[model samples]
Target chain A: MGKLFAVVVTIITVVSTAIFIAHTWWLPPDISAHGHAIDRQLSETMISSGVLFVLSQLALALFAWRFGDREDGRRVKPFPGGATPMVVFAAVLVGAEILTLTLVGAKVWAGVFQTPPDPNSLQIDVQAEQFAFYFRYPGPDGRFGATHPELINEASENFFGLDPARDTSARDDIVVPTLTIPLNRPIALTLRAKDVNHAFYVPELRIQQDFVPGLTIPLHFTATQTGRYEIVCTQLCGLGHYNMRAYIEVLPQAQFDQWLKDKAAQQ
Target chain B: MRVRDLMLVGGVGLGGTAMMIGRAATPPGATISGKVTFTGTPPKMKPIDMAKEPFCARLHAAAPVLTENVTTGPGDALRWVLVYVSAGDQGSAPATETVRLDQKGCQYIPHVLVVQPNQPLDIYNDDSTSHNIHPLAKVNAEWNKSQPIGAPPIHAKWESPEFIPVKCNVHPWMHGWHLVLTTSHYAVTGEDGAFRLQGLPPGKYTITAWQEQFGTQSQDVTVTGSETKSVSFVFKATPY
Candidate 1:
């Protein structure tokens, strides 16, 4: 019986260590901004988690192997001291991790969301609908028209449901489905939802912002990559929501300038 | 006893089927050709906000107003619309490719194209607001995803077959067609309402022609590399 217990304990230790070492196969999909923070915290946290997991397994194994099944008349003695220090140590470790994570997390989120748009930042107005995104440029005027909320309709196909007939300011508006922005520039996006809540998420750029009507929420991001990436709607709005998409053209600085000039002339 | 047997069989069956599907599916390229025309009445030329819709309003020398409404009365002017064909192969039977559907000026440009099975079909938002690519497909994966400016592009494909209706939820005036075909031979109507599907395998086949408001028609045809087969699909819809 003693031999049997020892063998089981060895197996448990081996399996635990194997899992800790070979975790890449089952690494969770990294889709959040917090994933970036992990680059700094990963090696430290992983080493700690791995060491603790192994040590606990080994301790449990050693205890089981030592005191498991004994035929000899050997009695165990109770500890004069209780396991208080171990508990306190664990609490301190967890508390420290939480505090550090919170501090670092607050900073990362603030960098993307908390700051207001810089005056020179390029701004685009986005309206989310059932399964698509329509982008608006302020034209040369650089101002969004005063739109009525009740005019928002997806069924009558009144997406953005703006009553152009009533809202005279909307007459000069240019509505396009794709968004083209210059590279290496800070862009402030103003999000609005026509019918329901929608989220704008670009994976490569690590940006995700929600669109809510009746409120013009602004989100800012700078694109580090220049390739054409996809702009997908991350909100569940309706039946045809699975294939909603928009093109994001990141032009060179010169081409971008030409585009702005062309746009201005057309306006 | 029945439940236990079903569980054992279902797991193995699904696994085997999935593997076979993966083997059978192969991706072959498809052709996307269609015409842009004023369907009912062509709207007039107006200067549109260039900052908002940059790529869509391509007419530099022409008028700039990106009118969402179709021309109410008829004259031959380039219309705005997007048309593409895609197929849904639930199992892996062929190659995987994708096509783009751009929604600009409240119309679907290029009105028709073809897609392969299990390809990542991208739906684009070019207008300055919102639109939806509502594909009414059953033989394929039927779902809806939205796109806001700077949002991730919606990547979808088919695992089955069906005539899909693509609509913009935000722009009630915006509508288009997504044709998901198993075969590669298909065409879209041009300004003169003509489409030709070339390079068909040497065999007798049933060909179909469809229009959004005009309805659909099918005909029997034979094709070979040496033969130039002529086919016409007409939609007889009286003035509504």
Candidate 2:
């Protein structure tokens, strides 16, 4: 039974290690500027953890095979240098790894979140409602309109509840269901939730932020590729959460401007 | 045997008379009919592009559906305007018939639907794709659910009086309204922009005509027994 146990343990260890090395399930390609830093940090963590895991699993298998029950009545042997060596080794290895991860991970996080947005970054207002997302652009005035919750009527496409009759600034506020931005240009989004909790998650962008009720969260990213990607809601807001997605179109500067103009005309 | 037969006949007659009397206790109600007209030029509705869902796009390949935000017909008559008794005595019990709202071709069949509080509402997804029905109810509990193709209809009810906005998250342009009221005497204007609120008891009541884009216009209407009250509502439209 002991021999069988050792063999099973060895097989499991080898299989798991092989799977990890093969990278069967890996992240999607990074398409954001700051995503490269995040990717680096993730790879570093995975490598360190993978090495530790393989070494520990192999050590466990060797110990189990050598220390199995022996009917010869052989005296038990303690590990070399006793428990103190093991404790010291674990403390040093884990402490160093944790310190390195913390330092590198904090920098990556700060780069994506804490750093101020570019001075000329395009600003867009995003409102996450029950099951859809509506983006608002300030139009030619470069000023956002005030949102009136009572005036929100979705049938007329007033998803943001901007009262053009009362607020002149709201007259030019352009709202669309899809998000369009220029590639290689920094874009900052002010995320607000009209009803419940929601999240903005873009796998390629390597950025995910929660939309807390009554609170506005800011997120900024620069897309490296010019293509259409989906921005899905990761948080389970309701039954419609699965369908809550919007297309993010990253276009060139000229095309993005033209698209904005067309949308503004529709408004 | 003759006496028993006579007694049975008398009992049946008494029961019939009591039922008639119960119905007669309430006077025959009055009706309010009117047309909803627009004064200015309504905004042009843009055609929806259902290209995201090939199933819906193919369904509407011949003729694309336009936005129903402001569906105006001939003579400037507004369509889909909900006219209901806003304030008056509570009428009879809610209709037992279930109100059905269908999602077909990625659009809400009835752009605007009226239901009484606690009335049964069944939402069905008749398209080949899935739809996420979300009713944003402020006074009542707000909920959302997804209905896949061929899935059983969703049975839901609203407990409070509110103008709930219904939307399909899968199709962002798909929007509808569910107006929940206490009175069942309501009518939605058709292509002729005419509505009739029948069986309204003789009393002073507030008649409200609500258009999705033009907001709401209400007037005080007094109905005397079995009289047809004529009320017309004119909404000022904007291009935007």
Candidate 3:
């Protein structure tokens, strides 16, 4: 029975580890400029933790197999240095691993979040509602209009509650459901929530940010590739949260300019 | 045994004849027709923006769609108002036929739809983009479901009568109402702001008018014979 248990544990550990090693189910390819560092940090943590997991499981199995049953009725014996030393050593080793990973990961995290966005980066405003996301781009005026919550009326398509009638900047503001950005250019998004808490997650871009109702959060990223990716909401906001998603279109500089001009014309 | 069989057959025939006679004695019912109009200033309708939906944008490029919250017609006529027998109603029967709501051009075909309790409501998505239909129901169970392009129509029904505000989360401007009334006699005013409630028995009925923006108004109407009673409702509207 002990031998069977050891064998079962060994098989389970190997199979699970093999799945991760083979990358059968992994993240999508990174498409942002700062994504490589994040990927590296993630792999480092995964590899270190995986090795520890395998080693601990194997040691457990070995101990169980060797001391399965004392048919001779021998009393239990402590380790050479007592259990305290072993416990301390294991705790230190695990703690060191965690501390090292944190130290290394903090740099990457700071680069993406803590550091301010480039001054030349294109600024966009994002509003997250019950189950939809609306993106606003400052039009030719290059200024965002003030929003009035009282004037917000979804039926009239005044999503941001911009008083276009009075505010000239609001009149030129372009609001749409799709987020389009120029490739290889820094883009900063100020996220706000209309109702409850919501999250913006783009796996390819390696960017995830939360939107609080009373606060505006800023997220910055630069897409290295010119492709369309899905932006999904990770927060459990409401019943329609599962279907809350939008598209991010990264276009070339000239194409993006043309797209903006066309959008502005419609507005 | 033979005599008993003959009596059973005779009894069945007599019962059928009596049932037919009883049904024939009932009146053919009167109709309540009226026009819904507003007196004061109403809010101006704003054009909807469908640029996010390219298909809808191109569809309505020629004539843009307007908001339907307080849709007003010529001569202070109010459209999309639900008029029904609220009180003193004779009776209500279970709805058997299905009601359909369409999502086309990123807009609900009928701004307001009427359905009876337990009536099957079929919602169809005719647009290319997927739409999440969220019905905010207070009395009945609120549900949210998405219908992708080319997907099957969603078949749903409400257990209780409630005024549900239905909206498509994908398109913020897409708003509609689902009025689940217990009374069978109800009509939604058309573009001309005219409504006709037919097959109403001769009795005192409390007719109620419900608008999504404006609250509600009720009036007691009495029908004496099988005749058409002309009634009118004037709602005091505000710009705000």
Candidate 4:
């Protein structure tokens, strides 16, 4: 029975560890400028924790197999250091690992979140509703019009509640479900929630931020590759949260400019 | 015992024949036709902005789709009003036919659809993009499901009568209504604001007209035989 228990534990530990090592389910390729650093920090944390996990599991199995089913009623012998030194040593080792990771990880985190956005970066306003994401680009005037909640009428496709008839700045505002930006250019997004809480997550870009109702959050990122990626909501906002997703298209500078021009024409 | 059994059998046979004859003697019923009109100020319909969905926007680029909540017709006529026999309905047949609701150009076709209780409703996504159909049904079971492009149509039905408001969360601008009616004698007004409730049995009935934005109006009317009775409803509309 003891041998079987040890074997079961060993198999479970080995299989789970092997899956991680083989990258059976890994993150998508990094396309954001700051994603490489995040990936490196993630790898370091995983390796450190994984090594500790394997060692501890193996040690437990070995001890159980050797002394678990001793039929002889012999008095159990304690460890040489009376368990205090061992407990202290383990605690210190785990604590140091956590402390080191946190210290190293904070730099990568700060780089993406704490740093100021470039002054020339394009600013886009994002409004998340019950289940859809609407991105608004400041038109030629480069000014966003004020929004009135009372004026918001979904039936007329007035998702942003802008009074284009009276507000000149809102007349040219281009709102779309897809977020299109120039590749390698900094992009700052102001996120607002129309109803409940929501989250904006793009795995390829390594960016995830929350959208709190009644508050506007600012997030900045720079995409290095030109491709179409999915932007999914991670928060459990409502019944349609599972279907809440949009597309993010990164284009070259000239193509992005032309796209903006065409969108503005439609507006 | 033998005599009693023979009498029981005779009674059963007579009862069955009489039921058949009674059903055959019923008339084709009366027809109630009406026009729904409004007085006072009506809110102006604004053009829908489908710019979120490029495919839908391009489809309606020439003439953008307008809001339908308060759709008005010529000469104070109101469209999309539901006229039905609210009272004096002599039982209703079980609905078996499937009703279709389509998502095209990022909008719900018909805007307002009427279905009987337990009737099958098939929702199809006709656009290239995905759509999540959520019916905010309070009395009946509320369900939210996604229909992606090329996916099979969703099969659903309501067990109880309710005025369900349906919306596509992916496209917030996509709004619609599902009115589950218990009476088979009902009609929805067309663009001309005309409605006809056919096959109503001869009796006193409370004819009700329901407008989404203007609330409901009811009037009592008596139908005789298979004659056609004319009824009109005038709703007071507000600009706001």
Candidate 5:
């Protein structure tokens, strides 16, 4: 029975390690410039963890097979170097791994979040509501209008509650359901929420941020490719959260300008 | 003399039959009909842009559709106003007919729909694109599902009386309302802003009219048997 148990444990360890190395259910390809660093950090962590897992499982299997029940009444033997060596070994190894991960993780986070956006980056405002997201761009006036909650009527399409009649600056504000930006350019988004807590997650971009009501959070990213990706809400705000998704269209500079022009005309 | 007596008997029998038919034709109930009007200028409805969905945009390329938030018809008659018995002692029963709401042109066919508690609601997506139907109900269980193009319609029923806001997650501009009530006596105003609630028992009841933007207005009314009562509601509009 003990021999069989050792064999089963060995098989389990081998299969799991093989699956981890195969990378079958891995993340999609990183499409952002800063995404490479995040990928590297993830790979390093996985490798270290994978090695630890394999060593521990194999040691357990070896001990079970070597120290099985003996009918010869042999005295039991304690591990070499007693408990102190094993304790010290675990502390040193785990402590070093934790230290390395923390330092690397902090750098990666600071690079993506703490670094200021470029001066010439295009600024866009994002409003997360019950079950949808609306993106607003500063029109030719290069200004955002003040929002009034009372005037926010979805039926009349005054989604942002910009009172054009009273607020002159709001007249040129362009609001659209989708986010479009020029590729290879730094894009900064000011995220705000209307009613409840929500999250903005773009898997390909390796960016995620939360939108808290009454507070505006800023996120900056640059897309290296010109393609369309889905922006899904990760927060469970309401019943419509699952369906709350929008598309991000990254276009060339000239094409993005034309798209803005078309949207402006509609506004 | 015998012929004259026989004719008299036949005439008497015919008169009794006619009286019985007349009584059966008119049930022992009252009716309430009214016009929901608004004073002051209503906010202009902006054109809806379905550019996110190319198919929906192309469907309305020839003629654009306006928002239905505060739709006003001729003579300031408010459309899509729900008028029903807010407070009354009428026994309720689930409607036998299934209420159907269609998603066409990326917009709800009826901007406002009213249903009784536990009434079956059949929602269909008649457009070529997909739609996610989400009903945000606080008192009742909230549910949402995606219906792809040519997919089967969703069959749902609400067990509680609450006002639910329905929206298509895929299409942000698509919004609607579902009023679940316990009373079976209800009416929704058309373009003419006219509604009629018939077969109401004779009693003192409260009639309420609810507009999506202007809120609700209610009044107490007394109904007598076999009578038609006329009522009118005027909502003050704001041009924000």
Candidate 6:
């Protein structure tokens, strides 16, 4: 029985190690700035974690197998009151990993949220409700019009409660169901929630920011690749949570200009 | 090492401004569009409970039908079927173009809408009751917003690829979908399992169809600028 258990644990460890390596090795190379950072950090942490995990598990298994029925009755030895060095070593490993990651994470957060709005940046106003994200570009003036949530009426074609009659600023404002941006330029987004708290998250970009009601949260990032990436809400807001999706197109400069021209024509 | 080091490595690796080249850089792509319908018998339209959303329930009576009425003939077809174009040569950024999805009579209008990334979506709720738009997207931002009648509409955009489902919490059964694509070329098959898309620069294209209940169907076709090609796809019913 003891031998059987040992064999089983050995197989389990081997399989788990193979699985751990397979899962981590198969991911595509990191491309986004933040995504790459987190990916490398996570990969290193995982490699170390995986090694430690296997070592500890194997140690435990070996001890159990060898001692499972030693009916020889050996006296158990108690850990010395202080194994001070061992205790300190274990504590330092855990606390230090957390501290280091936190510090690195804080810096990444700052990069994502603190950089000043550069003139070369593209600006987008994002309004979140229930389960969807509404993005507004100041249109030609770049000055946002006042929007009253209280006045929204979808059937009457008064969505976003632009109050066009009352707020002339919104008259030229363009309403689009999708979002487009120029490639390579830093993009800043201001987020707001009309009713409840909602989170804006995009996995490929490795960014997730929340939309606070009555408060605007700014999130910024520069696209690294031309291909379209996916952005989804992390917070579970409502039933539509499953179907809430918007499109973000990163166009070349010239095409972007044409899009602006085309959109302006609508007004 | 440090975060800056990480970023330096990432920045160098992800350079080129990630700009969107024209559709020319993208291989040729075909469009697919079709209406979803039912044959033989149509299902009975039952009034769904909008108590949670009495405003919507009060204004609309039968559940909105995008799926063909399948009670009398064939089987339950086209009802809540998600049909979309799946494969195509990638396209440029999402146009400033916008699609409006209205919440009326406790249902989402334009039941099936296909959009590319970076485009805007206007969510409007007309009924006096409140309605929420939630998109369950893993690739794009996941958001939930509620609109009360007499309030402003909620506008949002997608920066990535995702298949979003819209629903009204007030009315549990009220459902709809917002399909976001990374590529600009795509189409949703209609009831007759037929789809059409025009405007091509002439090239080889891959067209795919999606059905919420029927899974996915795909095919490849070639089109020249002055040429129109015929494509057909069928999805046999299967229990998912």
Question: Judged by lDDT relative to the true structure, which candidate is superior, 4 or 5?
Answer: 4
lDDT of each residue in B1-240, candidate 6, tens digit only:
111221222223223122122222223433334444443332233333333233544554364322221111233334334433355453545456555566766666545555667677777776666676666677777777768667787878888777776655444445667777766455443333334554455666666666543456566766665555666554444210
- lDDT (tens digit, per residue) of candidate 5 on A231-251: 989999976677677889999
Give the DockQ of candidate 2: 0.22
lDDT per residue as tens, model 4, B133-183:
999899998988988899999999988888898988777878988989888
True contacts kept of each: 0.15, 0.24, 0.43, 0.57, 0.43, 0.02
A best-first ranking of the candidates according to their DockQ comes to: 4, 5, 3, 2, 1, 6
In candidate 3, which residue pairs get closer than 3 Å at backbone N, Cα or C atoms, i.e. clash? none
Give the alpha-carbon lDDT of every model: 0.54, 0.80, 0.82, 0.82, 0.81, 0.59
lDDT of 4: 0.82
Better of 1 and 6 by DockQ: 1
| Residue pairs in collision within model 2 | none
| Per-prediction TM-score to the true structure, in the order listed | 0.47, 0.76, 0.67, 0.65, 0.67, 0.51
For candidate 6, give the lDDT of residue B150. Answer: 73
Better of 2 and 6 by lDDT: 2
Candidate 5 at residue A183, lDDT? Answer: 91
Question: What level of docking quality does candidate 1 show?
Answer: incorrect
The reply for model 4, stretches above 4 Å from the true place, is A1-10, A65-69, A73-77, A80-89, B1-106, B113-166, B169-171, B177-240
Best by DockQ: 4
Off by over 4 Å in 5: A68-77, A80-85, B1-65, B70-106, B112-172, B177-240
Better of 3 and 6 by lDDT: 3
Interface RMSD of each: 8.2, 3.0, 4.1, 4.4, 3.2, 14.1
**Which ranking of candidates, highest lDDT first?**
4, 3, 5, 2, 6, 1
For model 6, the superposed segments whose C-alpha errors exceed 4 Å read: A1-10, A24-33, A73-76, A82-93, A156-159, B1-240
- The superposed Cα distance between candidate 2 and the true structure at residue B207, in angstroms, equals 7.4
* Docking quality (DockQ) for each candidate: 0.08, 0.22, 0.24, 0.27, 0.26, 0.02
Clashing pairs in 4: none
Cand 5, B chain, TM: 0.87
